[model samples]
Target: MKILVLRFSSIGDIVLTTPVVRAIKQQVPGAEVHFATKPGYRSLLEANPYVDKAHYLNSSLRELVQELRVEQFDFIVDLHNNLRTSLIKLQLGVKSAAFDKLNWQKWLLVNLKINTLPQVHIVDRYLAAAAPLGVHNDGQGLDYFIPAEAEVSLTTLPAAFQQGYVAFAIGAQHATKRLPVERIIELCALLRQPVVLLGGPEDAANGQLVEAHFSNRDAEKSQSRILNACGQYSLNQSASLVRQAQFVISHDTGLMHIAAAFQKEIYSVWGNTVPAFGMYPYRTKYHILEVPGLECRPCSKIGYEKCPRGHFKCMRDIQFEPFFPAAPAAAAPASQNRVG
Candidate 1:
């Protein structure tokens, strides 16, 4: 069978679909699995072995559809169940199944503060899209591949981080999803270990702020050295850094899921979004930190440029010491590569 699995964009959401891809390939006899995603994420799937072919959405959806028509997939698995996928299923005219996004459940949770959503992680829900095809979760968790050539060499990082470091992903898609710069600086003040700040070019300034704050505060101390690596490397290179770290601390974002793929213990900080959405770290040792029992918590199903309530207490009032007791090891060895 020739199957086309669709999850169009985002680092973390696409990564979450890997289990469905693996199940389709392993369980379906003679299955040739193809994945469709945005072009920027080509790197994420190119290195993956289970996906036999990859189709990237181009400038025109019609053109992308035409390209897929040639492959004539036997079925469709829509993990990203949105309007775009709906249109694709309509155009392809194929027998297909899609994951239920539970939009109403999310709406009730976000707007009414009512708890109606399931506790299942999004990965398991994504897998449900393939149930008709007899695909089952192998319980191995998510998949991420870093080609050997793309690996970030430890020698290339600052000498201070050569021994060990905590990889902290400091950026999220929305401002409200991340801690304010002041809060981040406050947390780093207590870490007392080598720290590598991780993010894209957009986060470079904030990463610099964190690094500069420490650089001036403790000019002579090497006990806690901070390196601002935002915008310095590609996504896979950043994943390489995450793989090599002793553990990872991240705002709710893509790197957090990447850390889970590596099975690195993760400390996931929360803001307006809560863990009940089931996007938390999957099948890995993890902790969730958020300001609990606030009436204004989960103000949005997604996030906002600023807090809707103007107080931002969901993130501002969060406590760290209780979630993070002992500091991570000063020299914990890096994890060995499990994916090619």
Candidate 2:
């Protein structure tokens, strides 16, 4: 069977679909699995061994539809329930099943604060869409593939970190989802062990700001401990760093999910959104750091450009102690590779 699985855009959401891809390949006899995602995310899927082919949506929908028509997939699994995927289903004229996005339930919860959504992780919901094809969740959590070449050499990072350090993802897509710079500085200051800050290019400026704040306190003392890797590494390269870390401290972002893919213990900080949305670090041991008992929590299903209610109490009031604990007397270096 030739199957085409579709999910478009974003690092975390695409990573969540790994189980579906794996199940299709392993359970379906003679299955040739092809995955379609946005052009920028091709590398993430390309490195995945279960996928037989990677198709990127770079141009017009009509153009892609024309191209895919030739391949003539036997089944279409739509993990992305957007209008674009609907259009593709219409055009392809193939039998397809889509994951329930729970749009109305999310809308009711976000707007009315009524809890009607099912208590299931988004990944499990995604796997459900494939039930008709006899695909089952493999219980392996998510998958993130880092190419061998992208691995960061121990020699490249600071000598202190080469031995071991905590990896902290310091950025999120929305301002409301990230911890304030001052809060991050305070948390890092308390972490006695060496640390590495992880994020994409969008986070470079904020990383610089944090580095400067740390530098000003005691240039020689603090500067050597915190390394800012934002903007300096590609997505996979950043994943390589996460793979090396003993544990990860992250905001609700793609790296948090990626760290889950690595089965690294994660301290996931919740801000504008709540884990109630069911996208928390899947199948990995994790601790959630969010200010409980706030009625205004989870103000949006998807985060806003800025806090909608303006108070932004969801993230501002977090207590960092529970998340960090005291650093061990003898900290071990992070792992460079996964051992089978």
Candidate 3:
């Protein structure tokens, strides 16, 4: 059987679909799996062995349709139920199944705050879309294959982190979903181990602030153990750092899902959005740190430029004690070690 799976952009959403792709390849006899995604995300699926082919949507709908038509896929699994995917499926005219995005429920929750949505995680919902094809969740978590070239050596990391370190994803697409710089500094101060801050170019400024904050602190009292790699490394190299970490602490963001792919212990911080939205880390043991009993929580399905309410108590009021037992100690220093 020739099967085509679709999930276009976004890092976390694409990572969440790995299980579905794996199940389709492993369970379906003689299956040839193809994944269609935006050209930019090709690297995300390039190293995935289960996918026989990776199709990039580089041009107009007509172009993509013509290209896919030549492949003659027996079925299409539409994990992204957006207008673009709809157009693609309509153009292909193939038997297709799409995951329930619960758009109406999300709309009601975001606009009306009605809690009628199911508590199921999004990954399970993605898998449900493939139920008709006899694909089952294999109990394995998300998958992220970092190419050998992207792997980083532990020796290349600072000396203090060589023994072990916590990977902290200090960035989010939306400011409301992210903890403020002060809050991040507070959390870092509380951690008893070394920490490596991770994020993209948008987060580079915040990373600099973090580094500077630690640098100005009294080095004798506490060791400055934070390494800012935001915008410095590629996505897969960040994944390599995540794989080496003893634990991961992050907000509701893409790196949180990437940590899940590594099966690392994750402490996820919830802000304007809650895990009730079902996009939390999949198939990994995790602890969610959110302010309970806040009626104003989950103010948005995605996130806001800033907290709509202004107070932003959801993230501001959360206590990090439960997530980190002992405050992180000062890092020893920089040293070179290789990470496999």
Which model is ahead, 1 or 3, in terms of TM-score? 1
Reference-based TM-score of each model? 0.95, 0.94, 0.93
Model 1: ten consecutive residues of lowest lDDT: 331-340
| Lowest summed lDDT window (length 10), candidate 3 | 331-340
- Cα lDDT for residue 43, candidate 2: 76
Supply the global lDDT for candidate 3. Answer: 0.86
lDDT of 2 by residue, 1-340 (tens): 9999999978899999999999999999999999888899977887899999988788788888988888899899999989999999899999999999998888887778888888899999999999989988888888898989988886898777888888999989999899888888888887876778999888988888887776676665634678888999989899999989988889999999999999988878889888878898899877777887788777887787787778778888887654445762222223211111
lDDT of 1 by residue, 1-340 (tens): 9999999979999988988999999999999999998999998998999999999998999999999999998999998888898999899999899998999999998889999998788999999999999989899999999998999989998788998898999999999999999998987876867889999999999999999999998788764498999999899999999999988989889999999999988878999998889899888877777887889878887899998879999888987776544665332222311121
Q: Summarize candidate 3's per-residue lDDT along 144-248 as a digit string, tens digits.
A: 999999999999987788999999999998999999999999888887787899999999899889878887884674556888889999999999999999888
Candidate 2, position 96, lDDT: 94
Q: 2 or 3: which has the higher TM-score?
A: 2
Pick by TM-score: which candidate is best? 1
Please list the C-alpha lDDT of all candidates, in the order they appear.
0.88, 0.85, 0.86
TM-score of 1: 0.95
Better of 1 and 3 by lDDT: 1
Candidate 3 error regions (>4 Å): 220-223, 325-340
